[model samples]
Target: MFVNFRRIRKCQCVQLITTCLVLSLMMVCWEQLDNSVVSHVKSYSYRYLVNRYTFINKSFTIPREEAQSFSNFLYLLDHPNKCKGQDVLLLLFVKTSPENTERRKAIRSTWGNETYIRNTLGVTVKVVFVLGAPMTKPEQLLWNKRAGLGLQGELLREDLLNGDLIQQDFVDSFHNLTLKLIMQFHWAHIRCPHADFIMTADDDIFVHMPNLVHYLQDMARKGVMDFWIGHVHRGAPPIRSKDSKYYVPFEMYQWSSYPDYTAGAGYVVSRDVADKIYQATLTLNASIYIDDVFMGICANAMGVSPQEHVYFSGEGKAPYHLCIYDQMMTSHGHIEDIYHLWKVATHPQVKQRTSGLAGRLYCTAVKLALLCQPYHFNTYPCKAAFL
Candidate 1:
């Protein structure tokens, strides 16, 4: 009986010791978690608060008419082999206006040519021009009625002759450009969510299809996920001047500086991020006139910061030189300059002469000279290296 009693005591002792050790380990883990929280708070910037406050104060009310805007909004409008029976590497969505036929044509001929991008670069690509009709107007009421311009069940019957239009019924004006972006993402989520990456560019920007493809291919090899990359703007202050088009009053946002965002001129999002951003669009206050700022808001909700690439010029023209052209991705403000830039960028002499390391050295020297000269460098962010 004494031996049995001693055995019981030993068992109880072991149990007590195990319990004490587990409790100590848990306390240690909790201390580490508390320290991490302190570190996070110490590094907090106003940009972090901007995201939280904006999300917390989200005014995500969709009017009955607007709620109906998502259905049959963008049915296969000229998507070349849109990941059906194949894997699509990239899907490019270009935001275009209703009357910009010339811009669309120029884009189709130049970098927007899906066939050219695929054939030359050997990757599956699809391009779609996103469009929406202006708000229902009085004199144009009959035309709007015929075109099925709203949630009145006529949205699917609209006729677009060329078949490249991803038309929705929302008003396509500057005030509603953010809606345009929202509609684009919604369509992609429903139509092409399997795309490896989705890119959005303004109709005015010039996309260097070859360079972009190669860069993305390299990323694919590295197995990147949750990606967003562009010319990132960090710690940009809001335009409080009421006269400015980008004005944001204290009522709209209380933050001193806006969150980091890529310029609306052009940007890219990975496939998973597209769905997340689309859902974010529904939950955030998107009344901000600047589309990119709104995009930053959505991206922040998903904890994604855009990776910066210096070659992706933000609201500026990339410097015009063979070396710059060789590594450039997209240059903003390029409507009339699109075709000329394409020709210059893809010149035969460029291929024959500047083929390797020696060419890079010569171009780097020339770029240094331009930078040191003072006149051109001040106006342009000239650099020869590909980022």
Candidate 2:
């Protein structure tokens, strides 16, 4: 072939420039790439292939003296008798903020209503709100003192009216979620130890009382122990970026992957597991602010593995359908529509639609279409359609 040296040189230059550009782009995007891909790979490898997390116990443990500083908050609002004298099946601790009165109200009227749960479901499910002190921004602290007082007074009145509030003295903020987690276990241990199961959930989460109660009743009948179930997050890597809210410092948790944990949006544990978690909190360094991840560490220390329940949502709302409602255990991120969703989800038609062979087949196909998607919806996994 007749070739021109000049054209060949031009092509070589173009190739060199393209390769250099690609290299530079990769270098620039390396951190993101690590966060999205490399970190997960490392996490999964550490979680599954290597398969040992015993070191987490020693690494995360602090002296009991040091641990007390995190959990030794005074209870500002408490009802010691809330679960007393009742044969409580489930002690639900809904983590809420001091200012979320409307959320509490909605929950009480809907899923968290002990009265409705007793009358309709014929179960003694005790629902209580866990919270810390109302805090204001540093700059506004002085001016907001009065506002804080008003909020406090309102919380007291609300608690008196509902008799379901459990408050502590620590400042209520995102970083204090671990404290709230500690509070739940600690309070449950002290006040409601007789309950068959304990559940920790967010205020925004909606629990299908009928489904959850039935599940717990079965587990109780089977005499289940060390039982923990939720939307399992297996081999989840920590976010290393400083800007991210979920970022874990290398000094705090140097591990590549966390111990398997359920989504903190909602999860359930048997009475024994709750005691194990309470003991874990007493020794483990509660510095990890992400409550769910901390729960994973605690559970890992106590040798309680989280079981995956496909119907338990992580961070997304379940699909709005009768098939979903029929089998749904929990759905996260509910706020304004909580009352409406509660009414619809608990309607008798949901059970009717999923009852017989024809209904079962119809729902199976409908769920397969809704749940088995190419992309994750964060509510239920694709395999949920089969169940």
Deviation of model 1 at 379, angstroms: 9.3
What lDDT, from 0 to 1, does candidate 1 have? 0.72
Q: State every prediction's TM-score relative to the real structure.
A: 0.74, 0.91
Clashing pairs in 1: none
TM-score, candidate number 2: 0.91
C-alpha RMSD by candidate, in order: 20.2, 3.4
Q: lDDT score of model 2?
A: 0.91
lDDT of 1 at 61: 40
CA deviation > 4 Å runs, candidate 2: 1-31, 141-147
Worst 10 residues of 1 by lDDT: 151-160
The lDDT for every candidate, in the order shown, is 0.72, 0.91
Clashes of each: 0, 0
